[model samples]
Target: MASADSLSKLLRCPETRQELRPLDDSKLDELNEAIRAGELHNHAGDEVEQTLDAGLIREDDAVVYPIRDGVPNLLIDDRIPLKDSD
Candidate 1:
């Protein structure tokens, strides 16, 4: 359950080698469960990737984002911010 700030810095695409800046963690839990229950699909619907890549959606208008590795980077920068705001 990594925070959004941490996830942002660690998130990266394996194919295009691009960095992903998705926005909700609490909501992300639903996605993770959906992926597990087969309710939702992956980048290639109906087919899931082995990696933690998962997927992303705006999730309402509150900025609920996703994460990778074991942490979530919510910061709006390339490097992890030392201080995060609530």
Candidate 2:
């Protein structure tokens, strides 16, 4: 996997065109907790079935795109909204 710094330089939100940064560990943990508990769903309304290895959070911190096995899932329907969470 590319280091966060490298990924940050290359990735952007497909919808917003905003720069993205790695999701911090604390937030990743919280996200996984929600995923494990079946409490989170993607914008597509499908339950997210796998825990993320990493995530890219948008510059404004409004959403995150999941990275699994070193590949980013940037599909619009797969972006998880951060503003709606606790």
Candidate 3:
């Protein structure tokens, strides 16, 4: 299995095909907060119940794919949309 750093270099958004990189720690904290608050949902419209162990974010920061057990779940329907901030 490839290391997360190497995998990130090869990963792309399944829908937009944008380059993906490991989501930064600060952003991960924010994501966890929303998840704990029962406020985040995936593209499939299901509430994201599990706190992400890690994640990959697209270049534009529009969405994130959760990484579980060192494997990225690249399914389009599993992608979580990000809220825009002013």
lDDT of each: 0.40, 0.88, 0.88
- Worst lDDT run of 10 residues, candidate 2, spans 77-86
Over all chains combined, what TM-score does candidate 3 have?
Answer: 0.87
lDDT per residue for candidate 3 within 14-50, as digits (tens), equals 7778999888999999999999999999988899999
lDDT of 2 by residue, 13-44 (tens): 88879898889999999999999999888878
Q: How do all models score by TM-score? A: 0.34, 0.87, 0.87
Q: The CA-based lDDT of model 3 is what?
A: 0.88
The residue ranges of model 3 lying beyond 4 angstroms of the native Cα positions read: 1-4, 84-86
Question: 34-57 in candidate 1: lDDT tens per residue?
Answer: 557655433222333222343333
Q: Is candidate 1 or candidate 3 better by TM-score?
A: 3
lDDT of 2 at 60: 94
Off by over 4 Å in 2: 1-4
